[model samples]
Target: MNRRDPRVVRRLSSLRRRRLAFVVRETAARVTRILLIALGVLILLAGAVLTPLPGHVGLPLLVLGLMVVLRNSFQARRRFIRWQKRHPKLIFPIRRLMRREPEILLVAWQQLLRSEKVVLRRPGWRVLKRGRKAVRKALGKTPLS
Candidate 1:
């Protein structure tokens, strides 16, 4: 209980020490994220540079950079997911190839079937498509297709 006691000083300093530790942790996390993002960008640039050099490291470096960036970044992950959803036919095959699986063949076949265009008789098809676009334009709506 005496002011001169070491235990008293330690007890008084504990709250300030915890606050300092919390601030350090938060600052460290921000710095780590920045570093990771920078590292990922540098790696991607390296991969791009390697692409025309006739080596096998380019694609692997690219994937590694992508993984690191995505793992560290919520914004990048969201954007990537949106892009993937918009282009599954393109994304699916790449995903399969990355996994070293032959399932991409099946995915290609599925996409081929799904993409088979039908130009035949639907009397109002043009009217519907055009009308939808016109109405969407009038309403200022985003295009889904």
Candidate 2:
């Protein structure tokens, strides 16, 4: 195990090769990250352009782009967190979608109920709150927690 022992030491050439391989791996990783970030940005742009369409085609693309960007870029994650704190209600759905196990149906239902409340505002209809409570209960989460 002595460093001076010929049998225990690697050849200088092999050591150099190892360092070179490490450098290549690191460079490749950096390039891949940059490329992914760019791709994510392009997807986000496309989503924004398609958002006004009637079929709801762009929302998923936006979420996918956001996930990619957030996963690959530390700056994006930090900015997103800052914005989320400033506007929790606006960012709530996006945060939910970003979770490892996203509640897509629940978010959709909640948005639907919210739109109904906004458009109708019937005093007798407590469907939004009740829907939240029911979904939360089913998921073993406390309502409004």
Candidate 3:
């Protein structure tokens, strides 16, 4: 017997829908990258047969594939940043909750490593600095062991 607020349920449903859409878009981007890479490979192969045309056409095709890959990479990164922004409070405690448990820590670390936002590093560094400041204020300069 789970008692849940209707409004909360609705909000969760909305969030889930948005997340699904993001996942679909991300998947599409990845598929596009693969298609572009395949296209570039085909173009380069065709250019090999065509000689001088390859230098002109193959180069641009390769560049186009590279650009598509980079664009998809950036979009994933932006989505990660947006997710982190939406879920800041979940970060620190989630870390702390896993600290003592090595298995959990390893799993969490792997997930974090996979995250585009976490790969950025600088934002995480800033978050850590802020956390340290807050801890110092709360505990009066107690050195973290």
In lDDT terms, which candidate is top? Answer: 2
Shift of residue 76 alpha carbon in model 3, Å? 19
- Candidate 3: where is the Cα deviation over 4 Å? 1-3, 52-145
TM-score of each: 0.58, 0.73, 0.37
The TM-score-based order of candidates, best leading, equals 2, 1, 3
With candidate 3 superimposed using the best TM-score fit, by how many Å does residue 94's alpha carbon deviate from the native? Answer: 50
Superposed Cα deviation of residue 29, candidate 1 (Å): 1.5
Q: Rank order by lDDT, top first?
A: 2, 1, 3
lDDT of 1 by residue, 1-145 (tens): 6988999899879978999999999999999998998899899889888867886688667766877788788998898789899998666655664564446456555554444424524545544456657999999998888
TM-score of candidate 1 versus the correct structure, residues matched by position? 0.58
lDDT of 2: 0.88
- Give the Cα error of residue 105 in candidate 3, in Å: 59
Poorest 10 consecutive residues by lDDT, candidate 2: 4-13
Q: Write the per-residue lDDT of candidate 2 for residues 1-145, one digit (tens) a residue.
A: 6677786566765888999999999999999999999999999989998999988878888999999999999999999999999999889998898788999999997788778878777746767677667888999987565
Better model by lDDT: candidate 1 vs candidate 2? 2
Q: What would the per-residue lDDT of candidate 3 be over residues 2-90, giving only the tens digit for each residue? A: 33988888888999999999999999987887776566556646545554652436433433443344344666447545765889655
The 10-residue segment with the lowest total lDDT in model 1:
112-121
